[model samples]
Target: MEREKIISDVRSKAGGCFQKGEFYCSEAVIHTLNEFLSWPFDRSIVRLAAGFPVGIGRSGCVCGAISGGVMALGMVYGRDPGNAMDSRMFPVAAELHDHIKKLYKSTCCRVITKDLVFNSPERKAHCVKITGEVAAWVADKLLNDEALKDKIQPVVV
Candidate 1:
C-alpha cells in the first residue's frame, strides 16, 4: 500500500491520533510507515506505546515514537537476543534518535508542548507530525544506507 493510504488508515482508526484527539503528526507517520514496511504493525506500536504516557514518559525514558520506530527498525535489522542492547539495533536506533532530535529540537513531550499526555488535541497533532517526520527520516535513511536498504525490497506476493 502507498504510504499516505497507510497513514490514512491509521488516522481513521479509533485510537491512533485522531481518535485520541492528539496532533502527533510524527507518531502518525511512524505508525503509517510501520504498517507499510512491516507485518502486523499494530502489534508492535501498541505494545511500545503502552508504556508511553503511563510509564515511559513519567519515568523519562526515550520518547514513545522513538521507541516505537526503533522497535520497527529492530524488527527488520535486529540481531538475535543474546547480544541485546549493544547490538546493531542500538547504533541504528541511536542514529535515528539523533536525527529525530535534531529535526525536532527536543524529544520530550512536555518540552515539545506543555499539555498533559493524551489530553490536548493540539499536542496530539504535534506528536503526529513528530512521529511522521521520524518515520520519514528513518525510511529515507534506510533507503540511502546501502547495507540496510539491500536487506528489504518490495514484497513479491
Candidate 2:
C-alpha cells in the first residue's frame, strides 16, 4: 500500500473509533497503531493507555492523543529490559511532542478543549479530530523513516 493511503486509513480508523465512542483519545490512537503495525506488542498493550484519556484520567494535563502518540513511538523505539536503549527513542518522542504542540499550541487537554463543555458534541468532535491527526502523524513517521519502519515486526502467522 502507498504511504499516503496507509496514513489516511490510520487517520480515518482512529477518528472513527473515537467518533463511535468505542475508545477515548489515547485508546483510539494506540489501537489504530497496533492494528496498523500488525500487533507488534499485543492487543493487551492498549491497557497502558487507558488512563491517559481526559488527560491522565481527567486531571486535564497532557493531551491524551499526544500521550498515545508517544506510546506509539515507544512501541517502535523503546528498548527491552537490560538492553541498550535505542538512540532514536527520545528524539522521536520529542518530535511527536513538538508536532502536537505546534498543531494545538499546547499539549494540554484542558487548554485544547477549554472552550467546549465536557461530554458535549463540540468536545467530542475536537478530540476525535486530534485523535485521527495524531495517529496519522505517527503513521507517517513510522512509515517514512527506514529505522522506525524496520522496528515494526509484523506478527507472523
Candidate 3:
C-alpha cells in the first residue's frame, strides 16, 4: 500500500492571502480559487461571501469558509438566475459542506474557535490555516469533479 500526496500550492496561496489581510476566511477561500483557476468573474463577486466571516458577521454560526466554498462551487456549477436551481450544484455543495463540517467537527465558528479570540494572533493563525485548507479542498473539487470540470474554467497552471 502506498500513500499518495496531493501536490498543490493552492493551500499556501490561500493562506498567504489571508495572512496578508487580503480577505477574511470566506473571501480568502473564493479569492484563492479564482486566482488559481483564473476565472473571468468580476472581482466584486467575492463580496457576496463577506457576511459569512467569523460565523455570519461574528454571530458564531456556520463556518464562513464552508459558506464561501459553497458559493465558489455555485459559481462553477450553479444555474443562472434566469432558470430554476440546477440539479447538479446541490450535491456538490453538500459534499463540500459535509467534508468541511467533518474536518472541523462542527460548522459553528464559535464552536470551532471558542478557545481563540477574534483577530488575536492565535486566531489569525488558526483561521489562516483553516481557510487555506478549505480553499484547497474546494480547488480539488473543482479540478477533479467530472461533472464540474466541463463547466468551469481550466486551471491556469
* TM-scores, all models, native as reference: 0.61, 0.92, 0.84
Off-target runs (Cα >4 Å) in candidate 1 are 1-31, 38-45, 53-61, 83-88, 115-118, 145-157
**lDDT of every model, 2 decimals:** 0.53, 0.86, 0.76
* Model 2 ranges off by over 4 Å: 147-157
Q: Which candidate number has the best lDDT?
A: 2
Question: Which pairs clash (backbone N, Cα, C closer than 3 Å) in model 2?
Answer: none
Top TM-score prediction, candidate number = 2
Candidate 1: tens digits of C-alpha lDDT, residues 24-102: 3334444555554544445346444555541254554456666666666765676666865545667887798788678
RMSD of each: 5.7, 3.0, 3.7
What tens digits encode model 2's per-residue C-alpha lDDT throughout 79-129? 899999889889988998898889899999999999999999999999999
When 1 and 3 are scored with lDDT, the better candidate is: 3
After superposing candidate 3, which stretches have Cα over 4 Å from the reference?
1-7, 146-157
Give model 3's TM-score versus the native structure: 0.84
